[model samples]
Target: MTTSDDEEINPVTMLLLDQKDDDVSQPNNNSNIINIAEVVVPTAVEHQSYHLNSITSTLVIRQLPSQGLSFQLWPAATTFVKLLDSYTPSNTDPFSLTVTNAVTSVNCRQRLRILELGSGTGVVGIAASAILGADVTVTDLPHVLPNIEFNADVNKNVVGTRGGGVHVAALSWGKVEEMEGVGREYDMVIGSDVVYHDHLYEPLIQTLKYLLLGDGDGERVFLMAHLRRWKKESGFFKKAKKWFKVDVVHEDGPSGKSRTGVVVYRFARKDAVFR
Candidate 1:
């Protein structure tokens, strides 16, 4: 009689394989388990959203911990900003609707040369361009341009190959005189979620005054989106009114607990000389 040789499988290995096989065979039964496993698995990408200016769109993004990031740009008309007014501060980002509404409210017309200040993710200006059909220039600190440019490139295909404009350049509010080289007075100037720091209030106001066009039959308008903050000392809107006719475009309800107002300010230089 010949001795028969047999291979032995480790119990743990067999159990794992058997489990996997069961998973494959009874897909419906294991669906919940698979979902729970997926949920527990560490994901490289943390989710994010960007407002794209070149096409007037809001882009949803996910940043992979290992790889870089991926984005999908969609028209704001398609993706509405959620109203998270009463949620706990930790659960939401306060600026979403404030910026979206401010951008949507601007009265820009085609060929209404426009400028956006602190164009973070380029949302306000882009929405203005798309809705108002104006050529838009997006300006921010130099460091912020790459993301803005990258987003513009990704969405260019959808917005189209021509007409709307997106130009990126460094524009610290106080440095307006330097940016004069870019040429032309903007018909409309806009900013959103930009005035948090106390030191910035003055410079931000100065930026508006410098960029505003001389009054020529009501062509020049400046719009700002602000949420009331603890940093505000006093007479903030009063000071702003000194330079322009301020209007409260829309105000959030008592539920809007974030310390800012969803405001739209239209500025015209008090001394703007009309032809």
Candidate 2:
């Protein structure tokens, strides 16, 4: 089915929209579905370690790469980890342009509550918890929770030493009950490559609205690391901008043959973004 320019598919009411099951799962030219890695490790379990130079510790995460995209590491996730690892109370260059004051406030409190959507392997959330000494809840599909829990377990000591913690939960986007279960008590929301597919745009935006636009006291921000892979992705941003004032906080220039740079965006409510 051909989609008109003005048509915005309601991701919650209709997930597949006009596309059939097979077509929806098929590899379109700009589809974000990636499944090309072939791992030969034991039971196809791969372990990735992130060294936090600031804290002088390492966080180890397990990945089920054979399972699919949700089980492996992505480019944007690594970017977020590096940014968070470099983040400090005095040097907040990563969050310099956008939400700087809010981040500083949270850092001063040392009680930053973070909720990570689509936590996947849980590396980004786990790293944030340890680096900022914040309590973080990393969530994803129910089926994907085991791995996230595993990673959180392995890093308990690392985060515990820093006075931070990690919690694993299941949060499927666009699900009202699930979103309610996750709650909106977070000072910051984070994700990496969460804007890949077109169908996921509206639902993800719905959840973002529920978190960022609702009645809140302090500054609420969504810091997302994204690697722009397709021109069609502009529509998602266009739709998101209506409910949020998005800004580029940090940009990772392309290296080697990698032409696309990973960008970290800070999404805040229209009023909160300025304040």
Candidate 3:
């Protein structure tokens, strides 16, 4: 959903969440009934022309990628692409580089298990494994996995030629029951440009809590990149802080208009001593 920069409310956000679920006739959880309207305005950058261009000519693109972008954005069986004819290759994917920097700064080990949520094109996770040598598992919805797999398949070749591990799977963050006992918790969890809708905030947080490793050698750190929008209130970050010590470790902009172009958040489980 979108609005003119000056508008106080975004009708698009409300409309995006208003449609009834297609599976409504089937039995479902009551919690699923909550639509996007219940939450405050969503804070996310509209991808615009450049972000899509990053992958437009790469290989595959989605017809209507999840981001709020135009028809020039290509939708595909897996990865989405849009032409970035104007932007330099370095600026083509701002979010991807942000995640890469976070993983590198943390000194993630190549041998550790790593998980990535909403790995749209699998860029960050794959790059991390390639650079750090970590065994990576890239995940998204079942529908999104095939494309992630394709990306992983390509990365695996790059890494194997260089000696690294890359894997892909289907993961819906809030579906904890399905994800239980999959394996040991990951040492690092990475997400890029993922938080947008207010309705998904609680569920996304809950899912992270469930998957995080809290003890032993399995420490977990979650890093996310976002382009701040009005609906993305500080309160939302505060709400997440209750579960983990949240910090806006990095911020940069012209992501679009007056809004910050890219922001990096690092979160770790809060300790009692610190509190």
Candidate 4:
């Protein structure tokens, strides 16, 4: 699984190659093996390289079957990275400037500890590490860890060059013990495209509650870039309102497509909530 300095590994090709190796060992009588390309939406792993704040980082991503939507590179992830990249500590930009000032002030001697929930392809986390000089941990499901780890490795040099660091881990929503094991608290929690599923709403809220309010550090906030796909997704916000005060920090419909919505929100715990 080692990649050379100039090369980036492709996730889909690696998976198909593994399947082919399996087929060679145990031949199936049924010749109709499913082509992953047809079943998966994107069908291929996209190698995306972004140059932000004079640092370049690359990510390998693929959409796999039955693994939910964690494989592909969504627009929300890209938007989140762009938002992070656009900020500087001296800038008057509201949201990004606020994040930069807060994190930098709190983490003066050491790098800021940032945990990205549902870090598909690890793009946003990697960018945050490289561009912002923060120590970022990218977390997702166990099945998604391999790709996330791979991308982290691929961009390790880039992050290191910027005096930042990256780590990858598996974090399932609503798992209190797992959350406790990962770390006590982070300067910030981030996610993108994680609000689609209706069933995940409550679990996601619980996870946020722990990360933001579980410990005594109520200063922490959840920064998220969400794509408004279905109307039902609004329920996530409604449920989150009970424990968190949510703010739409930024919003835009890219390329003038009014129907396509992308928003960046900041979530902080309510004053009355005592953990």
Candidate with maximal TM-score:
2
Local accuracy of candidate 4 as per-residue lDDT tens digits, 179-251: 8778745888899978866788888998888888775767788889876656556678888998898887788
lDDT against the true structure, per candidate, is: 0.47, 0.76, 0.50, 0.70
TM-scores for every predicted model: 0.57, 0.81, 0.59, 0.78
Deviation from native of the Cα of residue 137 in model 4, angstroms: 0.8
| Pairs of residues clashing in candidate 4 | none
* Per-residue accuracy of model 3 over 87-116 as CA lDDT, tens digit each: 232542543443444344454344656777
lDDT of 1 by residue, 34-56 (tens): 23544854433333444444334
Tens-digit lDDT track of model 2 for 174-227: 999999998998878999978877899999999999999887543788999887
Query: What does candidate 4 score in Cα RMSD to the true structure?
Result: 12.0
Rank candidates by TM-score, best first. Answer: 2, 4, 3, 1
Model 3: lDDT equals 0.50
Residue-level lDDT for 181 in candidate 2: 97
Candidate 3 contains a number of clashing pairs equal to 18
